[model samples]
Target chain A: MKNTAIEVLAVKNLKKSFILHNQNSIELPVFDNISFSLKEGECLVLAGPSGTGKSTLLRSIYGNYLTHFGEINIYHNQSWINLVEATPHSILNVRRQTLGYVSQFLRVIPRISTLDLVAEPLLEQGETEVHSINRAKDILQKLAIPETLWDLPPATFSGGEQQRVNIAITFVKEFPILLLDEPTASLDQKNKQAVIDLIINARDKGTAIIGIFHDEYVRNAVGTSIFDIEEAKHAA
Target chain B: MTMSLQNPLLKVENLSHYYGDQIGCENINFDIYNGEVLGVVGESGSGKTTLLKLISGLLCPNAGSVAFDTRIEGLRDIYKMSEPERRLLMRTDWGIVYQNPKDGLRMNVSAGANIGERLMAIGNRNYANIRSDSSDWLEKVEMDLERMDHFPETFSGGMLQRLQIARNLITKPRLVFMDEPTSGLDVSVQARLLDLVRGLVSKLGIACVIVSHDLGVMRLLSHRLMVMKSGKVVEQGLTDQVLDDPQDPYTQLLVSSILPV
Candidate 1:
């Protein structure tokens, strides 16, 4: 049982910085040193004050910044990839096909229908639009998005409605590693709890989740026996 | 019923709105005192948006009246006010930022155009004045003035929302409406944005009506909350009261649903 349960994604001594024009010759270290690992069917919540670079770490993991220094080891399909050595194209491939990412914002394709929005993840992996559309509808129904909302651009939906669409896309992909950024922030209490329940449910189904969450209740809900990122610092 | 004794900047009485025989919301009555954040929380299609529209003068009420501290064009109630009067009154005291940053903004337009568009509609056409004014507001919203010439595409989601906020608050309108302002942001970004919004709202003493579904978001930013269900407000009170120990079944279900566990 122990041998079968392996990490889905692991980072070693991840470091990132930026140059500020006002501060000469000195780089502004957003994340001084950060490292964590997420196992299959498990989740780790990153909690911190604003501007502490919590979002930056997620972006770095997703290769949103190209200049970051880090060694991220992702285990996919029985093969371990040293993400530090992986090429940009390969990393993009991983992101596109294997990584389920929930960006901070609901980044929908403008003017696209809601059904198409949820189906984009499936399409990213070359799934046929007809099959993807059918699957997207099922996921949307489970997520509690109304059927009438399927054809309208998400711009017309309430803030909560738009958030549900963002979430529906996350589960449409058959990925092991899920990266979510405040997935429940727009939802009301009922929907937020439902989402948390879904994540725990998804975890049990073998999806490793790395989420930057501010909800203290969600952190405690996930329980202990975790790889706490706050304790790790620059030791690769 | 013994009414709330305290004087209110904005007052609602038996307020109701409908969409083609469908009750958008009904029997809504509340008094919003000056300098407080009144939050409205509910599920999708619970009529919170319609309530905001009615209260903000964006849509006229079908059944009741909204009385403002300062009347427009000698009209006593918003429902009875004329379009030109609403425009003149809104210019002086109403500001709104939508949930979708794109809706709150003009996406293809430059940052300057986005901020100045509203100002121009209200008849501020001096170019230098618009630039200087919008630039200072951008700084207030924690945006870099150097990127002031860029379009919304070049900006991140958080920055775009911030720009929308700057444009709304630049006028220092007395009443501000925010519909899920932090809905599409990361926690870190949400924290910063909420802080900026709360700080600015408090500093200017602007009375605000924020419609959000996030209990945490509402609790963090609002003084009071009005929990809605179906098409009516189930409960309205201080945030601590409504969220901690709700008596109404719908409100109770809502409070319980936020377990985060």
Candidate 2:
């Protein structure tokens, strides 16, 4: 296994902004001439006010936006890949293979069962359905979601159950990077700490997490080192 | 008017709402009073929102009764109130602040238009009066008057929440129900919005029912707190008593889950 403390992702002098109507651009510069690096197994959190471009910066590094003029380096296989030249499709492939994303709102397929939803990443990674289903059931049981609800469409599940399914999806594949957006916003205290413990457990397994959290309880529950997006946006 | 020391504005007698054949809450009983803030805290699916739905007359109780005497009416139970009576109360006596500000707001309409729509729903049609009233509440919620014409998409999430507040409180409803008001806001923004809601509820003497999972928020804002687990109200008491020294095991577990910052 690779050394867990080594740098995994690095960005240098990144700049990105949006345009408005009549040639007047809103120009939301999130990381104006900013440089940062993340080490393997370390989680970086971005906390800020709404519309401060915290989500935008995550999208930019994931190649969802064009970094106006900067370079990003992704470490892999004993070499650093200059992400500046990586195509969006390639970025997506890398993300799919190595990154996991969790949003504030868990997006389970409307009529799909919990087992199927959790098995998606595994199936996408070329695992057989039989193998994925077994893995899914195990995780669901471990998470304490009722076994009877496993085959039922997650639409009928409670808010906490749906979030548990979303959490299970993050663990399906051996991904290195996990991205979560307020994974516990609507959860009561019981589920909030459970989700936090789950994330910390995942980080121990060598996953680099990038989560957007608004709840102080969730933020303090996981990372001791936090990247305040409000300061980041203001400094820019 | 002197209220009886034990008089409750709204009383739930073993009240329960069932989603289809399933029980939302079992043998759930509680009493809410006028001008009081009652906080309901539970997991996402613990039926906190469902309880609010029942009290607002949005949903019918399947197993129990919601008995209340309102300032607006001739009806004893709002569930049995006539359509016109329901309309009247909705128009002037109650407001509901939804969790997703976008879901509660009309994205296409300007902020002013959103507030006007609330008035229009209640049959307020004089455009001049509506505009004046909408702007009045806009300032009541502490929102900028200049941005009244901007669509909800133009406003930030915190601003959108404020807009929803303006829309709901414009008519000065006697009571309001908030479904996770600070679910998706930043810490500072959440604190500000909570303060705004607290101040408004106090100034207007409007009773409030706020549902959230944050114990600290409930402790900071609610006079009383109800703890729900699975599908039951395991404990209910003064917010300080329940949160600071929870008697129920589930309440204690929940309190332990919260990390004080």
Q: Candidate 1's residue-wise lDDT over A185-221, tens digit each?
A: 7788778877777777777777778887777777676
Chain B: TM-scores of all predictions = 0.91, 0.92
Give the CAPRI rating of model 2. Answer: incorrect
- Models 1 onward score TM values of 0.51, 0.51
Off by over 4 Å in 2: A1-236, B1-6, B72-75
Clashing pairs in 1: none
Worst 10 residues of 2 chain A by lDDT: A19-28
Candidate 2: tens digits of C-alpha lDDT, residues A1-236: 23647777787877765433223433444557656777777878887778877776676666544554777777654567665576433354556666566654564324457887787667645577799899998878767788988887776778778877787887666667777777887678777777777788777776777778888778877764577656755666
Worst 10 contiguous positions by lDDT, candidate 2 chain B: B1-10
lDDT of 2 by residue, B229-251 (tens): 87789887666556644656677
TM-score of chain A of each: 0.87, 0.84
Worst 10 residues of 1 chain A by lDDT: A227-236
Tell me the chain A TM-score of model 1: 0.87
DockQ comparisons of all candidates to the true complex: 0.01, 0.01
The superposed Cα distance between candidate 1 and the true structure at residue B80, in angstroms, equals 1.8
